[model samples]
Target: MDCNEYCELLPACADDELGAAESLRLEQHLAQCAACTAELGRLRALRAAVREGTTYHRASPALRARIAAALPAAAVPAAAVPAAAPASRPRWLEWFAWRPAANAGLAALTVASMAFGLTSFMLQDSPQDAMAREVVTSHVRALIADHAIDVVSTDRHTVKPWFNGRLEYAPPVHDMAAEGFPLVGGRLDYLNGQRVAVLVYRRNQHPIDVFVLRGAGSRKAAPDFDSTLTRQGYQITHWQAGGMDYWAVTDASAADLQRFSQAWRMASGGTP
Candidate 1:
């Protein structure tokens, strides 16, 4: 899908109102287009901000009673009215007549509630959430600046050793040209509070960035499985291989990313 088509359906996509097939197509477009991905992110963030910053409160029991009492007797249905009733207005209706202080209090509460909710959401972001945003921003910036790679070499020997004396840990580099993902080059990028290795690869013409960093270890015996996340339209597949955390970011389809991960594991002699 083109950017224009993607933009048209972005609201529905953000609201999860698209059909299965339409949603799939939209995601595919997002994976390959950096600008669209960034736009989607902005849309989602704006939606969240609006939702968090708005609030509606129903009237309290006392307030409800006051308003009900202020209504005119004629406002009630004939069948619901008592026979020979006094023709005075209901007490609740008095609120609208002259209770300025009570009306002002209700308005103030609404504004305060909205402000508090929005402020809390903005201030309560976790470290992991911040890291994910940083990772995505770095990936998008690299593409826009046309500085996706610093060193251009497909040789695993040359790429792996290029990180020498640059990072504390050694990042394994493998060529997966046979699997349709060819090593294109490598570069250095700072992310998640550390300088890391970014190995570049290409599946057809789309670039895939594989970021390598020191692993915090896996919850299981061996990090055999990979975790996938879709942000703004980019697919991020993370795995732990040889005590190094590998995060592969690309506009490639999830299936392609899975295959890339499997091929990488096999090439590195890591678990499937």
Candidate 2:
């Protein structure tokens, strides 16, 4: 199904109300569509937040005992009192009567939490914020999945050729081995609704992924196509070369990422 059709089923998918066949199709489409995948991620996160907010913790045994002790003596029958109760009749019966109301209060608190969390999350989701969130999530997923490199090689020739038919545009790959950001490998990734090349590199134990995609060339005739920013503690640098957009994301320092972007632009014969 197309994006619009898949989006229409997103709420159902989030609620697990879709049929098996339709769910399968949606999953297949999500594999290729980054936009839809990001949307699904948002939905799942929302559901998780709501679940977390609504979760209730039962009253502790100590608190229950204290409440029982504070009630009037005649309110509880002798059989209801525990061995530790005072000489007077314990009001365990009153405590039992109030238990349901306490539970109901907790339930109301959970609902309020869910509503507040949902509103807070929705308020922060501007287009730019969502894109940055997606970028950080993609970085985290790569680490968790342990599939950082699809074609592990230090050679640029080997890595660049791997994306020949997999993507519509050829991503320029460079071997920065001598420069300390060695080419570790490359992988095909979905970003911004298209399959792109993600060149992997490393500095010590830090891994950097450079996502490449087709972009409308620099908005001006001048070659001012380099920018850098940090999101979720990861440094990201964006530059355009040969009509393709490049974004390098890493835990490396800003200076290191900037150096890598400059080196990449030089290798691609683009302005720094």
Candidate 1 deviant stretches above 4 angstroms? 1-115, 118-129, 216-227
TM-score of 1: 0.59
lDDT of each: 0.74, 0.72
- Measured on C-alpha atoms, candidate 1 has an lDDT of 0.74
Return the clash pairs for model 2, or none.
Answer: none
Lowest-lDDT window of 10 residues in candidate 1? 217-226
Candidate 1 residue-wise lDDT, 38-100, digit = tens: 667656766786677755565566775565455432345567767888447867875455344
For residue 50, what is the lDDT in candidate 1? 66
Per-prediction TM-score to the true structure, in the order listed = 0.59, 0.58
Off by over 4 Å in 2: 1-9, 12-36, 44-128, 216-227
On TM-score, the candidate that comes out on top is: 1
